[model samples]
Target: MSLQTWLVSLFLLICVILCWSVSAQAFAPYPYDSYYSGARFRRGPLMGFDGEDTQLQQLMQNLKPRPTLLIRIASSLGCIAHIHMATAGEIVEVNWLAEHINDPHVKVLDATYEVKPKPNWEEFKNTSYGKFDELIKTHVNPNYTAEHIPNAVHFNLDVAYFPGQYERFSFYSPELFEQYVQKLGINKDDKLIVYSRGPAAGMLFAARVWWTFKVYGHRNIEVLNGGFNAWKSSGHPTESGDKSATQGNWKAGPIDKSLYANFDDLTNDPRGGNLFENKMSAINMLDARPGGQFNGSEPLGFPAPKATGSHIAGAKNVPLPNVVGETGVKDKSALEEALKKAGFDASKSTVTMCNSGVQASMLALGLARLGIKARVYNGSMSELALRASEYINSK
Candidate 1:
C-alpha cells in the first residue's frame, strides 16, 4: 500500500475505535435517479468499520489483496466489506457474458427497481423478484414489456441496499438479502449472471448486487457486460416467460469482507483526505460527470460550495458520456487506450466519485472491464464536494 493508504488505514482504526456510535446515513436509493443537478452534499462523519469481529477479515485475507492504496474495509449495518481500491476486479468484457448465453444452469438476474410510491410518500415500496422472468411478466415499463432475460431473477439492487434517509438505496438487511436470494431460487451451486437496462443505471445496479452476493457468501456471480444493451446490440437471443428457475439448498455464508471500503480509511485516514490534495502526482481523482459539470457548467442544482478539487492537479478527465455513449463502454481496446494515452496505470488504484455513487459506479465498471484498478466512492459527489471545501473554495 502507498504511504498515504497505510496512514489512513491506521488512522481509520483509531476513529472507528473512538467514535463507533453514529448511525449510517441512507444510501442514495435506486431507481437511484433524483440527480438534483445543483445538489450540494456534505461529508458525513466516518462511516465506521465492523472490525470488532474477525470472521469477515479472514475471508478478505483469503482474497490475497495486493499491497496497494485501495485496500479498505467498509463497515456498516453491523457488517464489514473489505473493499479493494477502484479498478480492481476481474472486469468481464461487455460482450463476454453473452458467450455463455446458452448455459441452462447459469441463472440471470434482472434488477428491475421501480418507484411505485403512494401519493405523497417519500418512500415507495420496492418489490424485487428472485426470478426475472416473473418480473418481465409483471412488466411496468414500456421498454421492458417487449422482452426480458429468460430464467432471470428480479433482484432489486435499488431498494434492497438503501440507507436510512436514503433507505431506498442502502444495503439490504442480511435477512432480506438471504430471503430475496432464496426467493429467486438461487442456491450456492448456481452461477448467477446479473444484467440491467443500460450501462450507468443498470450496470451499477448489477455491481451493487454482485457485491451483495459476495456479502452473503455466494461465489459464482457475474455481471453481464454492457447489461441488456450489450446483449441486444450483439443480436443475442432474448426470451420472455414465467419459467421459474429451481433454487438449491444454498446456505448464507458469512460476509466476505473483500467487497467493503474501510470507513476509517475513507474518512479519518490522512491518505483518505490527502487523495483530494494529491492532484500533483501519485493520485488521480476521476470525475465522471459530464464535462459541463466538471468544467463548471452548472446543470440541475449542483456545483456545491465545497465540491472543489483541482481534478487531481494533473488528472485526465474521462466523461461517461464519451465512454458509454447511448449503450455502454463495451469496447475494451478503446478503454485501455483511453487510459494508456491519458497516462493512467491500470494496476494503480483510483477513486471513482460522481454526482453520487451511481455514475462513479459506471466509470469504475468501465475501468474494471478494461482491467483498470478502480473503486466507487459510494459517498458520491455530495461527499467529495463537501470534502473538497477543505482544499478548494467552491464559492
Candidate 2:
C-alpha cells in the first residue's frame, strides 16, 4: 500500500511540472523571436541571436499597441514608422461649418477670385478696386460683400505674389508670407476652414490655400466641401463687408519639399528628353489640364497667346473635373477607379500639373486624402510652355 502509491504519485507530479514549464516558455513575450516576423533588423552590438536584444524586448513589452486608424509608413530601409494622413473628417461640410462658425478656434477663409483676362496693372487695379466689391454685392448677394462667407476673412490670391510679377503665380516671399500669416491670424493650434464660390472654384482657390498652409507647416487646415455655393444653397446666412483677423504668432516652418516641384526637378535628366519620358524618375507626371488643352487642340491663354498647346511628352492626361464633381472630391473607390482608368498608378510617386498651379494643387490634395503623397508643379504649363517650349510646342 505505501511504496507503490508513493512512487506513482511522485512520477505524475514531475511530469506535470515539466509540461507547465514548456507551455510557459512558449507563450512568454521575451524569449521567442517570432514577434519580429516582418521586421528587418540591422546587425549591431545590441542584437542577440535571431536579432532580439534584451533592451528591444523590454521596450516592446512596455510599448502600447498602435491605434487601428493609425497608418504605418515604412522607410526606404523597410523599417516601420508612423505618419498622419488627411482623412474625410479633416474635410469640413456645410452643416459642420454652420455649427462651428462662431468658434474662436475655428477660422473661416473665403478664397474667391475672378479670372482676369490678362496680367496688367490696370486690370489688377480695376479687379482689386470696386470689381471685387461689385462681385460680392451683385454676383454673391446684395447683403454680402464680394468676400462673403459670414464672419470669414478673405484670402486674396492676388496677395500671394509680389506686386510687379503678375504673370507668374509665384508664392509670396517669406517676409510677405509672414505678414499675410499675421493678417490671417492663424495660430499653430487653430483650425482653418477655407471655401470658395463653387466646387471648381474651391478646388483652385481653397485647395491652393490648403496646400500653402500645409507647406508652411500648419497642421489643422481643412477645405470646405461643396464650398460657399453649397453653403448658400443650404440657406445659410451671409455677412457683408470685409472682416479683419487679429495678429497670430504663426511663423513659417520648414517648407515641405515633397509637396512642390519646379522646372529644374522636372528637367533633371537631359538624356531623358521630355519630362514624362524619364523612366528612371521616381515620379509619374500627371497632366490635369482639360482634354483639349492636353491634346494640343486648344489655344494657350493670355500671357502666351500665340504659343500652341501640348502636354509634356509621355504625360498621362487626367482631367481635373473627372477627379472632382459638383460637391467635392469623389469618394476613394470612385477616385481610385477613375485614376486607374486614366492610367495613373497609385503605387508610383506622382507630380500634378495644369495650366496654372491651382488645379494641380487640387489634384495633389485629392491624392493626399487617399494617403498617396504627391507634388505640385506650381509653374505648371503656364511657365513650362514658356520655359520648356521645345517640349510643349506643337509641330
Candidate 3:
C-alpha cells in the first residue's frame, strides 16, 4: 500500500479503537446502581478509573476500624427526615422545628470562621482581629439572637474548624466533632438540617456537618439553600444566646478520611499526586471561589490576609458562575468540558478546596453530578494562606 493510503487507514483504525474503548467502559457493570441512581450523573474518564479492583476491595474488606461504636443516624430504615422527604420534612419544619428550636435533642448549630491577617495566625481566639465578618460575612447568623429558628442550638464554627498555623486546621477529632454534635442533643437518629447564609459558605459549612454525620455513618442531613439569609427571607424566626440541652452517648465511628481530603494528604500521597499540577487530565483541582481569590489577586475576606499562591498548586481555575435564580453550584457545560480536557474525570478522584472549605462545597456538588469521586479538602484558602511559607518555599 502507498504511504497516503496507510496513513488514512491508521487514522481510521485509531478512531475505531477509541470508540470501542469508550463503549466497553460504558457497559462496565455498576453494582451500586442497584441503589444509587445518582451515580449515573457522573462524568468520569473512560481510560483512567479502576473501579473494579476498588469495588472488589470493598467487598473483601469486612474490617471496620470503629464498628463497635458506629451508628447509622439516617438509614433507609430509620432517619425521619430522609424517609419523608416531602411530608415529614414539611411537618418537621413547621410543627417540630420552631417549637423544638429549644429542644434538647435537636441542635441547630452554626459553623462559622474568620480568616486571619496571616495564614498561620489563629482565629476566633482572644484577639482584636477575630471579627465575625472577616470570617464569612455572608453566612453570619445575626438573627439567631433576634429570634432563632426553633429546635436549634448555636455554636461558633470554631467549635469544629479551629485552625493553627503549625498544623492543618484542627478538626474536632471524630470524637470531638461527634461530642459537640451530641452535646447539642443531636443524635444519629434525629432529622437534621444545616443552613448557611449563602449556598457557598453555608453549603460548605453544612457539608462539614453532613460529612461528620456520614463518616460516623449518620445520613439524615440537608443543607438549607442560602442559609440564614434564606431562612429569614422565607420569614423564619431567629433567636439569640447559646442553648444547651441534654446529651447522648453519641459514639464516634471509624474515621473515614476517604470522604475528605487533607492538605497533607493532597501534598504527599500518590492518589493526590496530580494535586498541584494544571494538567486536568491528571486529576488535579478546581477552585470554587471568584477568579481573583483563586489567582491570588483579591483579598480573601475583608480582614483576611490576601490570598497567595496560584491556587492549589496545579489545578485549573474555573470561577463558580453567578447562575440566575440559583445560588448553589449550577450546571455549567462549558466548565465541565474544560475539566474533561484537563484530565479531571468525574469518575475519578478530585479534591475541591477553598479558603475555609465552604466554597469548595459548591464545587463538590457540581462535580458530584458529573459522577466524579470528589472530596472537599475542608480548609479554604485560609489553610494555605496561614501556611503560605510551606507551599511558597516548596513550589
Candidate 4:
C-alpha cells in the first residue's frame, strides 16, 4: 500500500475506536430512554475532512460521554441522598459549622444521656462519664456540670421517658416539643445539628432527637457523625457549665407518624401478642442488641425481666457495633452490606428496637444514611418484655 493510503486508513481506524468507546459509555440501562433520547450530538469535523466524510467524522467526534456510571446507576435505582445524616467532617468541613456557630439560623444540640438498667444506680454512675460527660451533663453539682461542645444547647433524653408504664419511653407530645423549641430558641427553618457521646451512647440519643425533630416536621436537621467523642478526639474546644440559648419563636408542625413505632405496632394486640404471627410483611423488625441478648442470654446487671428468653419473635438481630465502628457509623457501603447480610429489605418498612430503645436509634440512623426510612420502637425490649408474655429464642 502507498504511504499516504496507509496514513489515511490508520486515521479512520482511530476515529472508529474513539467513537465506539464514547457510545458504550453513553448507553445507560432501562427506564432511561428519555435520557438517551434527550442527549444532543454536536456537529463538527474530524481530521479536517469535508462533505460526506466530514459529516461522518463529525458524528463520531461529537458523541459526548454520558453521565458517570454512578449517576446512571443512581438514577436507574431511584437512589437519593439522605439529608438527615452528617459526618463529623461534613459539619466542620471548610469550617462551615464553625462559621455558622454564632448564626441565629444555626443551632447545635447536645443530646447526651445516661442509660443503665433500672434499679442499678451504681451502673448508671459508672456509665455516665467519658463520652457521655463530654457531650452533655445529665446531673449538676457545685463542683461542675458536664462538659460539652462549645455553643451547643442541651436536650435531655429524659423528657421522652415515662417510667412504670407499659411503654416506658414515648415520643414527646407536641406541647412538650414546643416547650423544647422555645427553650432551645430554634426556628423551624434553622439548621439544627445534634450530637451525642459515642456510637453506642450519645449517637443513639442524638438519633432520637433527630427522629423527634423529623416527626414534628423539622426538615432542616442533621446528626453529628461521631458525636462529642469524635469532636473531642479531633481536639475541638469544649466548655463546662450550662449555657443558655437565646429565646426564639419556634413552633411544632404536624407530626409524621411514620417515623416512630409503639408497642402496639410491634405486636398483634396489647396483651401477649405474637410478633411473628402478627408480623406485617411490609414491616421488618430489627433488634439492635448484642448477640447474647438476641439469643436469649440476658447480660449481667440488666434488670430482671417480667418475661425473658429471646428477642421479640420474628426479629432479626443486627448488632449496633456492626453498623457503627470506633470512629462512627461505618461508611455507607459497609452499612448497606451489614443490613443486607442481616436480611434487611430496603424496599420494605423497618422498625428498629434495642434493650431500652437507645441503641436502636443508632441502627435507625445508619439506615437513614442509606435513604431508608426506619421507624424507632422507643419502648423496645424493655417495654416489650414487660407488656408481652411471648418471647422466642432465635438461636
How far residue 292's Cα lies from its native spot in candidate 1, in Å, is: 1.8
Taking the tens digit of each residue's C-alpha lDDT, what string does model 1 give over 273-295?
54434442444556676666656
Q: lDDT tens string, model 3, 83-139?
A: 244323111223344555554445565543343333334443445233333443333
- Residue 94's lDDT in candidate 3: 34
Comparing 1 and 2 on TM-score, the stronger one: 2
Best by TM-score: 2
Strongest candidate by lDDT: 2
Model 3, CA-based lDDT: 0.51
Pairs that collide in candidate 2 are 136-146
Q: For each candidate, what is the lDDT? A: 0.52, 0.65, 0.51, 0.63
TM-score of every model versus the real structure: 0.57, 0.68, 0.58, 0.66
Q: Which ten residues in a row have the lowest lDDT in candidate 3?
A: 67-76
Candidate order by lDDT, highest to lowest?
2, 4, 1, 3
Task: Give the per-residue lDDT digits (tens) of candidate 2, residues 1-395.
Answer: 67756975675555445434443343355545456545654553212224534544554454334212121111111111111223234467889889989998888888886654335645555564323333333333222264477778777666654222323556655555766667667776678898877447355678888888887777688888888888888899887775766788767776677787777767773445435445324557777888887786775553554354466655777787877888778777787876787788756678888877888878877777677878888788777556655456442
Q: What would you estimate as the lDDT of candidate 1?
A: 0.52
Task: Give RMSD to native, each candidate.
Answer: 18.6, 14.8, 15.7, 14.1
